[model samples]
Target chain A: MTTSQNRSAFLSGMLAMLPVTPGIIPFAMISGMAALDAGMSPLTAQLYSVFVFAGASQIAAAQLITSHAEPLVIILTIWIINLRFVMYSASMSSKLPPSSIPKALQAYVMTDQSFAICAGMFDQNQVPYENRAMFYLGSSVIMWLIWQMATGVGIAFGSIIPTSWSLDFGVWLCFIAIMIPGLKDFPAIIAALVGGSLALALHGLPFNLGLVIASVVGIACGYLTEKKLSSNLPVKSDNDAKERFQ
Target chain B: MSLPTLWFVILAGSLGTFLARYSFFWLSGRKALPEEWIRILRFVPPAVLAALIVPGVIAPGLETENPLFNPRIIAALIAITIAWKSKNVMATFAFGMGALWLLQYVETLL
Candidate 1:
């Protein structure tokens, strides 16, 4: 691809991500405010946004910190929550060419939005394979900057926001927003309901292990449900059902 | 958690997360994850988020007393409706927070 073509691809990738930006602002703000509420200094809060860059995991970490959970629990929870990235990376690897960018840097900026945009564009042949790296960079870099700035704003104004407003609930609301969209199918609904109820039932478990156990149960429930459903239907390749879960 | 412990968690968490993100790229020769794994992994997000969210709304902090009257539960009910109907993140927050504040105000009057 010519330099001009690469630039255009990059610009288009960035522009495509514009619609997703507003949705992310609340999450970024929540992360920042949660961090401060959890007793982290403004600098450390901002640093979390900078270093972690994944909003859900950052919020989970902040919540665990504030609740005085063990450090191992906190770390394990964050890692488990982020395990989806393994699937994302694997799905993206075949599409993204080697040597397009440094592996470490590429991994650093690989986010849900960026991965979605790039993968969508590539699948639709909107961006050529050779130019995908440029496209990925364009989308991810802007998102990184926006996340940092939004988190900074949230940190600056977190204390000013009154407790009467009950913005702390916004944290759970954010998770609800993320979760509801994923409940498009029966198994997903079952996973969420079972997982949630199990967590509630076992909430008193020491060290917050209930969350981990519930997650395991929920995944198991969903997997079994999917297997049962698929078995009843005609056999299909795994790829055909891949999009069903996501 | 202590300062050093928090720092260690952050650093270690970051390392683990980055490795997960980098694994496929480093193992490009292996191709994608097995189909079974992908199918199972698909449940992770919803499961984890539900596990995290439910307790917060219902038995927040694992309180032993009645949780039915919790403002968060009512607000979450509203939030889930908005999330399902609107599918707008901002709308979910606005309606959820508005519901929580209103519920809290009502409790104060009682």
Candidate 2:
């Protein structure tokens, strides 16, 4: 890619991220409050925002801590909640500048928003793979700064946001926004039903271990069934031409 | 504030991030992610979500001393329906929260 193109892509990605900036602050603040409510100190909460910017997983982990769930269970839940990132990171690894950026920096900046913006461009195949990492880093740095400030605000005013209002629902809304759009096929439908039912059935299990089991089972069912099910769904072959196969 | 809990979140976050970030790099070099794994990963969000939502909606105040018909659940359902039909976040939040407050107001009437 030419230097001009690189600058253009970077500029576009950053611009696309601007609209989501206003939401990030409150989201992090709510998460910070969750950390505090779960007995996490202010410093710990801020550090969590700085390091682990995965918002949903942080709340899930904090909830487990408040319940005094087993440490392993808490860890396992965090892992499960974050498992999707495995796909994101893998997709991005090839796109990164393999030598200039160290593994540590890549790990830190790997996040949902970063991955989404990067992947959207990647799917378009406009930007070369080598420059994708810088695009991700640029966007992630901005998000990270927003999150840190939001978390600090939440910690500073942990007293104000009335628990009764349940601002935490924003996280749920965000997750739903992310999840619902992806449910565009039969496998996803089956996965959601089967996974949700299994989770409900297993809720009595200690330490929220049931969540892990249910998610795995749901994904397994979805995977095994998608081929037979999605065979009938419309599919397009290439971006150059719009031809649908049924 | 405890040392153990503090260390655990940090260690888990760092290790989790590293493992997730690297998993693709290592795997993509050899072969495409098996169709099964890809399909499986697709369900993670729903599964995690169900795990999160069902408890809140169906069994709110499970740990609270008293459990009853929760207005929050009612509001959530309404919100979800709005979210589904419209796919609007602001509408979902407004209606869901509005229902909760509205229901709470009705409860006082009875």
Candidate 3:
């Protein structure tokens, strides 16, 4: 792709993430308030926002702290809630081209919103190989900025936002909006159904392990289904997917 | 939840999270992921998304009680259709939130 095309890819990356911003604002605000309610100094709250940037886990940690949960329990809970990131990282690493941006920075900026957007783009080959990293960076950096700002707003103004708005649900809507496009195939459909069903059945599990278990089992189910379906077909190599990214 | 302990948790949590995010990238390094693994990973986004979205709508706040009466179910179904057909985020949010607010409003009257 030309420089102009790569530039457009970056712009598109940012544009794609824009819709998810509304969903994130309320959550970040809540994270901010939760930190304060847990008795962290404002500086430490901001530090929490900066260091452990994962929203769902951030709030979970705050609640854990407020309840005087053990430090190990808090870390373990956040880690469990975030194990899905390891899967995303496994997937994203393959899509990522070499970059001057440190791997540390890349990992730090990575979020579910960025992962979903970049995953869709790379899988569809809508962005060229040279532009994939740039595109991913574009989406992730914007989200990092937005998250920090939203947390700051939350910290500055506590409980001011009404629950009546149900803005939290926007988070799910954003995921659904991006995810619907990927459901055009059978394996994807199976994955979603099994995953959704298992999550509901196992939602009672401790520390949100249900999500982790559901995701793994659902992926395995989808994988096995795909394997069985494609048994008669020729084996497709990783290069084919890599070529698509190119 | 002492002062030092809170800071320690923040530091420790930060370290753990970064590891989770960085795990595969660090291990895989320059190697291309195996084909089998790639195939499995293809389902990651879909499965995870469903796992997240389904609970948020059906159970809302992780409440495990029977959602037989929850309006969120109806709102989510409408949103999913709009998301699939229109492929427009704004349209999904507008109609989804509108359906939800409308349903909740009607519920209050009854």
The per-residue C-alpha lDDT of model 2 at residue A194 equals 80
Q: By TM-score, is 2 or 3 better?
A: 2
Runs with alpha carbons beyond 4 Å of true place in candidate 3:
A1-45, A54-100, A111-139, A155-158, A206-209, A232-246, B1-13, B24-29, B60-69
Candidate number with greatest TM-score: 1
lDDT of 1 by residue, B5-74 (tens): 8789889888989998898888885865877887777788889999999988777533553454677787
In candidate 2, what are the lDDT values of residues A65-147, reduced to their tens digit?
77777887877877888887766655566556554556667666666666666666667776667667567667777777777
After TM-score superposition, the amount by which residue B48's alpha carbon in candidate 3 deviates from its true location, in angstroms, is 3.5
Better of 1 and 2 by DockQ: 1
> Per-prediction DockQ, in order?
0.62, 0.44, 0.48
Q: Interface root mean square deviation of every model, in Å?
A: 2.9, 4.8, 4.9
In model 2, the runs with Cα more than 4 Å from the true position are: A1-9, A95-99, A125-131, A230-246, B26-31, B61-69, B85-91
What is the C-alpha local distance difference test score of each model? 0.82, 0.67, 0.75
- The 10 consecutive residues of candidate 3 chain A with the worst lDDT sum are A237-246
Q: Residues B1-110, candidate 3, lDDT per residue (tens digit)?
A: 78888888889888888998998778756564555665776677677778767865776534653355566788888989988887665677778878888887876776
Q: Candidate 1's C-alpha lDDT?
A: 0.82
TM-score of each: 0.91, 0.83, 0.69
